[model samples]
Target: MARPRAFDEGEVLDAALRCFWTRGYEATSVRDLASSMGLTGASLYNAFGDKRALYEKVLERYASHSMAERIRRLEAPDIAPRDAISSFFRETLERALDDPEMKGCFVVNAAVEMGPHDPELRAAALASLGEVEAFLTRRIEAGRADGTIQNRETAQELARMLLGVHLGLRVLARLRPGRELLEGVVKPALAALDPHVPG
Candidate 1:
């Protein structure tokens, strides 16, 4: 029979996410993952196959883990989707401020590092954006029907613009004067999303 796995999968993957989140996929070596997880290089290979395999798992964990929870919070029934989406950006800003490490975002980081010329990685990054945008579009459409938001734009277009704000905000968060600069970006974003626009 095959030997049982030695390490806790969840703990190790979370560590990998943090490492990847901090250093990015290409910068993290197999030795780095092994040392960080208290595993030998061979053990890591046996458990996760290779660096790309491990990085893929890290991306999966990032989605199903706390990231999904954030989406859940935003889509929760108790909060209006419009309000919840606004709070999501503000909350992310707070999270960035609270963490002195300046990790930015996992998906945004991946988008920068691997988005171009890599079909698989680009597709994966785009799928995540699609998920968020679809969710936003649904809510925005609902809002439009209920007289909450103006129906000037299609749901799909509005969703894409909202996602653009997130992408831009993550990039801005990595800079030196991040928060104040982000506030400028965020405020204009809020105004653009406002339902009542005087003609």
Candidate 2:
């Protein structure tokens, strides 16, 4: 029979996440993960397999707690579709502003840093990004059906554009976390949703 592990899995995983978030995957080492996770090297390997496996776990954890939860809250049936879209961006902007470390986003960082060479990582990163795009597409479709979003573009097109804006905002925030600059970036995209606003 296998022995039960002694450490708190959630706590250690969170620590590993912080380590990876602070230092990109390529830069972070097994020793770093062990230190941050408060586990010996042997225990780290025995429990989590390896760096790549642990990183995959961390990505799953991040998506569940961050992206999945946010989508669930903002996509509630009672909220107006347009409002949900607006609130999504508003909350994203707020989070970017509030991040003192300017870590940007874990999923996005993974997509850029390691997604190109690593197929598994690439798929994982794309899946998270696709979730956001899917959410935006759904909301835009709803808004259009309800006559609230008056954009000329199809829901998919608008959703893709908004997803680009979302990615750009997070990346730019890392370089310049200024409120005026970020809000300026968002204003025009949001305006595109209203027909009354002259294109």
Candidate 3:
């Protein structure tokens, strides 16, 4: 019979997440995860399979808490699509500003760091990013139909450009974290959504 696990799964996973978030996948070792997660190496392996497997779990948790949660909240039926989109960027900007460690974003970091070498991680990263793009495309289409956003471009094109802007914001936040600079970067992109604004 298997022994019952004593440690809290969520707590240990959060610890592992912080360790990976700080050092990233390639730099983080199993010993580091074990130490941070308060588990023996054998216990960690038994419970989480392997380092790669644990990291995959961490990515899923991150998406649920960050992107998935944000989409759920901002896409409420009562919320205007344009307002929802604005609120999403506003919250992202605020998070970047408030992060003293300037961690940027976990998914974006993973995409850049491990996407080139690891096919599984690359697919996972792209899938996570695709969720954001799909959400943006939906909101833009809604906004256009309601006459709140310009129709100068198709929803797909606009969403792709905004997705690029979102990626740029996350990457730049790590390096600069200056309010004016980051806001300057996002302002034009948001402005382009205005129905009255020239394309």
TM-score per prediction, in order, is 0.93, 0.96, 0.97
Question: How far off is residue 106 in model 2, in Å?
Answer: 0.3
CA lDDT, every model vs. true structure: 0.78, 0.92, 0.92
User: Which 10-residue window in model 2 sums to the lowest lDDT?
Assistant: 190-199
Superposed by TM-score, candidate 3 places the C-alpha of residue 35 at a distance from the truth, in angstroms, of 1.4
Residue-level error in angstroms, candidate 1, position 107: 0.9
Off by over 4 Å in 2: none
Worst 10 residues of 1 by lDDT: 190-199
Q: For candidate 3, lDDT tens digit of each residue in 57-149?
A: 999888878789899888899999999989989999999999999988999999999899889988988998899999999999999889999
Q: After best superposition, candidate 3 residue 197: deviation in angstroms?
A: 1.1
Off by over 4 Å in 1: none
Lowest summed lDDT over 10 consecutive residues: which window, candidate 3? Answer: 60-69
Q: Following a full C-alpha superposition, what root-mean-square deviation does model 1 have from the true structure?
A: 1.6
